[model samples]
Target: MSGLGDRILGLGLLVLAVAYGWTAQQWPEPFGGAEGVGPETFPTILSVVLVAGSLYLMVKPDPDAQWPLGKTALELLISLVVLVIYAMLLEPLGFVIATTLAVGTLSWRMGARPVRAFLTGLVSAVVVFVLFNYGLDLSLPAGLLEVS
Candidate 1:
């Protein structure tokens, strides 16, 4: 039972990685000759990385790994909830707003001042939004900010 938790976590992540990769593959292929990255490319890459990491964990789990407790555990839970909420709200609130709220809350929980945390969130969100929407030529959902 020394590394039981790590083993179980590895198994869970392995399953998730397989499912995620499968789902990514289900996305329609880009409407052209397969000459560049498509919708599934990034996800597939992540899934591959996750799979490898999960396999390594299964093969050689950290015997010293211990679950966080008390405040640290609560913080992890809060971060998870924020991320889940961010995903749920992304399409409706837009990437920028949802990312700002998620990042700000997580930052505040990590001991940052409220105003500074939110300002950081706002700046990071705007930068990422611009990077994905403009630099990468990929369109994120504009949601509330959508122009007519």
Candidate 2:
């Protein structure tokens, strides 16, 4: 009973990992045929890792696991809401804007000053955007920033 919640969470994550991997497999092949790594590679790798972690959690539930309450619970709720909103707004607002807002809000909740948190978010988002769009050649939504 000590880690009942952890066990349940692990089980849930295991199911999610399976579904995620399955969904990744469903993506259509690239037009010219998948060369090196396709779009599904990263998600498939993540799902595999998640499955391993979930299995470990199920096998070794933390003996001292404690559920959050009061302020801590509220923070968790806020973070979840932010992530849900981030996903919803990603396409419309573009990766950079959506990510900046999500990261900034989460950083602020973690006690960073508002200005500094948002600046950090902006920098990180831009860095990631460049890395993915330029370095890796993976395109992320440009959202409102689209040139036309």
Candidate 3:
């Protein structure tokens, strides 16, 4: 059963990687001048890596790997619920608060200690904020916090 599942996942990942690579290749380059890597560069590289990883897994899969069952399913369900709630509350609650709450709740559900989970989630939120706001120069909603 586990082997079958892994095989299916591997195949799906392979298809996704191919599709992503093709899509990336089809995207037009915004500018012609020599500068930083184009938008397609990262996606193409990521797709290649995904394809290679999926192929490796398909070729040499572990026999003893076991899929998580009931409790894990419940945990995933809880995490999904929290994520959806966070998305819904994002506009009103603000990015930091909503993201921290969502990540912390998901981490706790996945068996992390409360303090550790909170810290991890807070750190994750900060990292995401820096990456998106500063590194990528992309704007996210400030919501109630007014960070924007």
Best prediction by lDDT: 2
List candidate 2 stretches off by more than 4 Å.
none
Q: How many residue-pair clashes does candidate 3 contain?
A: 0
For candidate 3, lDDT tens digit of each residue in 5-25?
A: 677778999999999999988
* Residue-by-residue lDDT tens digits, candidate 1, 1-148: 6778889999999999999999999987767755466778888999999999999999999889999999889889989999999999999999888889999999999999999999999999999999988987667888888889
**Which of the predicted structures, 1 or 3, would earn the higher lDDT when compared with the native?**
1
Q: Can you give the lDDT of residue 95 in candidate 3? A: 74
> For candidate 2, lDDT tens digit of each residue in 1-148?
6888889999999999999999999999988898677788889999999999999999999989988999999999999999999999999999999999999999999999999999999999999999988998878899989997
Model 2 whole-model lDDT (C-alpha atoms): 0.95
Estimate candidate 3's alpha-carbon lDDT, on a 0 to 1 scale: 0.80
CA lDDT scores, all candidates in order:
0.90, 0.95, 0.80
- Candidate 3 residues lying further than 4 Å off, grouped into runs, are 20-46, 80-98, 113-116, 135-148
